[model samples]
Target: MDLSALFSLMGKVALITGASKGIGLSIAEIFAAAGAKVVISSRKQDALDEMAGQLRARGYEVTGIACNVGNMADLEDLVKKTVDLYGTIDILVNNAASNPVFGPVHDTSLEAYDKIMEVNVKAPFHLMKLCFPYLRESSNASVINISSIGGISPEPGLGIYSVSKAALISMTKVFAKEWGDHKIRVNAICPGLIKTKFSEALWSNDKIMAHMMKALAIKRVGTSEEIGAAALYLASPASSYTTGTVLTADGGFTI
Candidate 1:
């Protein structure tokens, strides 16, 4: 098998959300390195510009756009600016997510639940809808939704977030099945205990880490780059025949 041919993202246009840092940043870097024209988005323009500059310095084609995923107007503007820059999007990574409250579901207020669902679930769904026309134009379009192991098995103090992720997973399958005729592949990634700022609360806690280690076969927190590699597989031609698949990359934590 020609591995390079399978994985190369040359000439492809990729848009990644929440890409200023963490897993999103890792995915953007990897995709850019793989030859994709990468457009990274987050809530802050300064952070995006800094990251974009660093990637450009490394000889990667990258552009940064600031967007708050929770806002409908922002989502539309994000798509517009990306297409204006790159013509069309061949890959879309829905990595932006929110979990303002980290407690029991019973304690989660309606406001908190709305915020979580809006950012984690609704935003991805809306963005996909916005990108559908352009995605259908690409011969090898792929959509990756970043979910969580919490969506599969609920974790303590993260109830509403888990629910939103589960919805995202389901949304992936639904879009995959519906868009198959359009040749637009949709998939979800469920990561477990990655060592990112978004997950520092869990990994940094001695008690949580100790408990997680007992169940984790690898006995260590996964890295953002690890998840980036997984996203690469899904976005590249390597996963051309794969869609509606929930790939779990949690260092055997799910096992």
Candidate 2:
């Protein structure tokens, strides 16, 4: 097998959600640089526009669409727009997620719990459903779900979010089995604590940082580029045989 073919994502179209900043945006950037026409979505159109413009300036084919993953109609519109722009969706990175509440499980309100599940798990599942047909047509179709190490092991003050991530991991397995016949490889990326704005609540806290310093083998938080690199591997041919797998990119936080 040619080694270069393993990492190539040329001639593919990828859609990423929660792509205005942090890991989602990084995935969009890396996917575009890998030669895939990328569609980025998030709640804010202005942020998406900026990201898309930056990627396009770098000579990659990229478009931005605003989407609130919690809304099914928005999801439908996102799919329609993606297909309209690129004709088909070859790759999908469900990187959009939420954790609106932070406290004990007992203190969590019903609304917060529902919101967490809606964005973190349900949205990914439904978006994949919407893209199933287009994904099936591609010989190199892949679905990369962004889960978290918090899902693998319970984290302090993050109850519902962890549960949702765990469900996402399960969803990844189920879809991998169901879609395997169509040659669509479904996988989950469980990132360890990355140093992104989305994770400021953890890293910005002095106590949490000290705790992580001792628990993590890598002795530092992960980077958005690190997650982006992992997404590229799973999105490209490098991971052709990898499916129904949770590729954890946390700085060895589990260990």
| Maximum-TM-score candidate | 1
Candidate 2: where are CA atoms >4 Å away? none
Task: Give lDDT tens digits, candidate 2, residues 71-167.
Answer: 9999999999999988999999999999998889999999999999999999998999999999999989999999999889989999999999999
Candidate RMSDs in Å, in order, are 0.6, 0.9
lDDT of prediction 2:
0.92
Tens digit of per-residue lDDT, candidate 1, span 46-118: 9999999999999999999999999999999999999999899999999999989876789999999999999
Poorly placed runs, candidate 1 (over 4 Å): none
What is the clash count of model 1? 0
Using Cα atoms with residue i matched to residue i, what is each candidate's TM-score against the true structure? 0.99, 0.98
After the best TM-score superposition of candidate 2, give how far the Cα of residue 242 lies from its true spot, in angstroms: 0.7
State candidate 2's TM-score: 0.98
